[model samples]
Target: MMSVCGYRWYPEYTVEEQYRDFNQRQYICTVRVFPDYPGAEKPIHWSYGLGVTVDMAVQDAAYSMLTIMRARHALLQNSELCYVPASQSGEEGYISGVYFDSSMEDPLLQSTVEMLENRDRDARALRMELYATRARLWTALTQLAPVVQTGYGEMEMLNPVRTHLPAHVDWPAIGGVTPLRGPLLPPVRGPRPHPCPYGSQGS
Candidate 1:
């Protein structure tokens, strides 16, 4: 099998005899597959089998290894090589004479799609929060405009008294004078401040 696949090296095997029940003995065979060159540093795959005879045990181990290679698309089937689609491979998805493990492709694609969806959701939430904050700030500023203008007018009206009164005088301690409180009064003149700049203008 290794020669057919263009590998110059062959599989290595180890066998051991084990005692079984009833004074019987069994053979245990282990096979290790290495890369094509001699003295390869590591074995690519390994399998073990047990049988009454050494030959049977070795054959069993070889069969197990072949099964694994077939599933990985490493072995030729019916004298024809299988091709994997590009979508499944996630890159060049299709190879004319090569096979790959198609099982892992779907999960990789699903994870990528899920990550994009999560990012989109987070961006939309941030935009909504920003819009809400701007709306609340505009509302507060608009509601406070009239009170600010009324206070400014009152200060202007009191300017004369402020200039004539002695510097030692404490207005809050004098008669018929009290601190401004309660609901704010309306502006004495002119139109109200304009609505929020972002809102539509209408007559």
Candidate 2:
């Protein structure tokens, strides 16, 4: 394919091995083609394949890449054909000197883009609803503040127990004693007189 396309560079291959057990192993091969010519502006074309041996994996990967290139008309049998740059083609699917069918209108890419758009729309809607809800709550609180204050004032004026209560109470000084700070307890009445020593006459 490179020779027909007037490319002098060779395709690079990388292999990796996955050992499932002592007797079971899987090999994966990746083939990448880089632009070697000076005036050729092309992105790297790559493909992957899996097999039981390194040679088999490499062959599989190479075959898959060639198949893709053939489908895209990237490989030309006649060297006399003029090459077209991807930029001049005005199509995103065009790479190197050929148009790739998969690059344009791919179902996976379309679906992914649609999914992201929907997610973004939902997020924007949620944020708008949150802002509106917050604004309504703030308005309700602002409108209710004066009514609440007036009701509290009326209750304070009508309650006689509250009116007679002292604003503050001073704790009596006790030697080496500290006064506890909390809700005040009612003052205790004077201690009751001791009972008579003798029992009641009726008893």
Candidate 3:
């Protein structure tokens, strides 16, 4: 089961955006394309290109999208046709050649499996804290102004506790010590469900 019987096919993409930080006139372009597989929860590959003109950016993006599509198609159909945007040399500006990578057990780009698991754990903790905070607010309001009418024939004004109040204060976890993950996806690429030649670690 550890050995791959055949190569799996998946789309690859890259997206990039470039702009001059000091220039207000520069435009930023984002291009995105994918296989559009139905019911796919994983992300699609993309590339970004920054250029002085809109045409330049669009041209690069289109070329990149085509390059990835052709590569995948060739691998899947076992065709002799192959697209190598640049030479194998890892030069600064040249396109790096594409090749098959079989180490699918590795972590996704910018993220690790362990980190993702920890995020889930942290999310559960934060949720519990949120519920605790809500409960405290309800209790405080009840005590301040119970089910009674004021002399003016209106509910008395209750100074509810501040929203910033801690649900379960843990000094050790305050500040940047234990930053909340919130709803952020890991800053890493996840393994493809089906292996692709671009650099799939597993099938």
How many pairs collide in each candidate, listed in order?
3, 0, 13
- Candidate 3 per-residue lDDT, tens place, 1-203, comes to 00111212433323233321112112233444433446555545455443334444454444544445554453533333331221222355433435433234344522443443355345435534654665575566555443333343234244322224254642222111322323422233764322221232332
- The TM-score that candidate 1 achieves is 0.35
Q: What are the per-residue Cα lDDT tens digits for candidate 2 across 37-124? A: 6765554677776655565567656655664554445345233322221211224332112333333445766555455445544543
How much does each candidate deviate from the true structure in C-alpha RMSD?
Answer: 37.3, 34.5, 23.2
Task: Rank the models by TM-score, top first.
Answer: 1, 2, 3
1 or 3, greater by TM-score: 1
- TM-score per model over all chains: 0.35, 0.34, 0.28
Q: Indicate the TM-score of model 2.
A: 0.34
Higher-ranked by lDDT: 1 or 3 = 1
lDDT of 1 by residue, 1-203 (tens): 55545553567777677632222345677878787876776887677755545655676566556544544544554333322111111233211122334445467565554554455445335534654654565565445556656774342321122123454652222122223533323332555333221233343
- Judged by lDDT relative to the true structure, which candidate is superior, 1 or 2? 1
